[model samples]
Target: MKSRGLLSVLTFSEKRENLLFLLLNEPKTIAEIKGYLNVSTPEIFPRIKEMETKNLIYKENKYYALTPIGKVVAKFFQPLVNTLHVIEENEEFWKEHNIEAIPQCFLERIDELGNCRFIENRLEEMYEPHTEFFENISKSELVMGVAPVFNPAYPAFFLQLALHKVHVSLILTKNVFEKVKNEYRDDLQRFLECNNTSLYVLDDISLAFVVTDIFLSLSLFYKNGIFDAQRDLISFDESALKWGEELFNYYKEHSKEIKSL
Candidate 1:
């Protein structure tokens, strides 16, 4: 059989792949590697040997470390693995939703939403604010959101957050803004008057999401163009929060700030 290439060397075995990842941060002695991976010397040594032969790793002074090339590969490889896991973990969600609303830049970094979980409302709770989302934002120091759809309760609820001195920033679609201005004028005015609050209006958007200091909550329209009110993707990971903030900022930059009405 022809010798397998570097791709196979890197990907063919889970042990080898994990060993490379373990070495990414720093070199490790065999004892450290064995303990970290919970594997015996006999099982791990052969994988390490194979990687060493491929020049993906090197040993010196009783420690194993990735070579320069290995470092580069791992740097790129980790993100690929993370991205795949993120999509595969929520394959039905990704397939059924309208992700085209997400900007290309943010879509590329989707892996930053590490270990996100779905929040699916029960049948009786359909169209209600997600309880977990509400509870998290209530305790957060800062809250930012994009609202492409309007809920009757949101105007008063978000206004209450602003009044409590939570830093609140929101980008609303023009239609939603109009609804708030016409029917919730009092709440809207008070929200705009708060020193810690800001509001902006943009053209129609296809998704709604919120990013707070503690979490991110994302809702998308279905492929059939109806908003999916029953499910949301939520994450408490720091990287996910940062990613969500960037996404909010991207929309904020293009929106027109509303000072009154």
Candidate 2:
């Protein structure tokens, strides 16, 4: 038999999707669905009938819940819905930034960036270190990151952070690593000498992101592959911090430790 057409199965209505998601947890009575959805029977019944006809749900006594097929379908649809919500939450950030710079595997799990916020330096402060960024990372006991580009302030600030006894780990792209070694050898030396710091070098990387115990900040390349220095997607949410740490670890695992530089 031919598979249900994509539009036909999933595109019935937004209410259907919401109902499917709601039922994934537990069966609910019509009154419960109506109360949770905040809609009257006239607004919700037709969608429920349609879902029932599609075998997406079943009614027993007074409660409605997903069928086995519906649960599987919801398992797949939830991610697509969640990923879209995340990207759209910071629509322009994801739109203008070169999201392709994010690796394919992590990009697929982009929804893991729960409740991220777009943060930008003011025009007058465009080239300066972000105050909020400094504030958040400064207070963390452990900080880790990947940097694909150079920053004049970072060498000093990160060294200071390490000196303050914060454990610091970083993965830098080759060019960025060399740039720091050539331009800020003293700071690089200080960082290396500090017991709290470790550095690694990757031949190439496509994006910049930092994760600390407190927060995560990510900056992406522009669509043409040029780095964007002015804006970052920042988040203090625990899930986002976990996601960012995984991203940092991905590059670190693929990189070589830089004991000298």
Candidate 3:
């Protein structure tokens, strides 16, 4: 019956049960607990009061610690918890996936084993480097962008910028828009509407480019689909940004000039 009740408590939990287990490690005063949990007295006292009411803990020298009941519960939970950790050992699924933003607090307490291998593999994947291109993008405070190919790699930089809330403006060419406009319009629109994003579309665009506050990038398209990495690419520093910005402004200001063709 006692073990069944313990299992019941574990099953009933909608969130972290680690705190209950941690409490059994030592007798601690209410103030000490509030401090360690980084929670306020008001938020914690009620739960402590409830645990005491259930006789799960008792006070000694004004320090409330887990009772024998709580200790037994914690011990019974250990094996079930450890069995839930087999997923951490898998290394394959993570290679093709990204889970960079999951926080530590969420990761530590997970005890389920079924998806453990996939998750472990997913967590081990590393960032792929684009060398100079990534370096320039990372250093920029302002990035003016256009993406013709919708590279999955491109979204990675945007996610990084999102963490810092950096400002970015994107002007995509007509050809790129038409190709993706029907299929990915909603997702692309939301990304453009997200915080710090400003987007524009330019029709009849003959070229593709991205300019950072300090650098400029240019790429050309081919009719035969023979686009190679070395073909028509250029990178320049501050001087290029200034020139590119001026060219962008001229094109933006004279939208009517290129509207027909």
For candidate 1, list the clashing residue pairs, or say none.
none
Better of 1 and 2 by lDDT: 1
Off by over 4 Å in 1: 1-4
Candidate 2 stretches greater than 4 Å from native: 1-9, 236-239
Question: Scored by CA lDDT, what does every candidate get?
Answer: 0.92, 0.87, 0.54
Per-residue lDDT of candidate 2, residues 159-257 (tens digit): 989999999999999999989999999999989998889999999988888899999999989898788888988888888888898888888889999
- Worst 10-residue lDDT window for candidate 3 reads 113-122
TM-score-best of 1 and 3: 1
Could you tell me every candidate's TM-score relative to the true structure? 0.96, 0.85, 0.40
Poorly placed runs, candidate 3 (over 4 Å)? 1-129, 148-152, 159-163, 178-181, 222-228, 231-236, 254-261
lDDT of 3 by residue, 46-79 (tens): 6666566666777789887788887886777764
Error of 2 at 152 (Å): 1.9
The TM-score of candidate 2 is 0.85
lDDT of 1 by residue, 54-170 (tens): 888999999999999889889988898889889999999999999998998999999999999788999888789989988998999999999998899899999999999899999
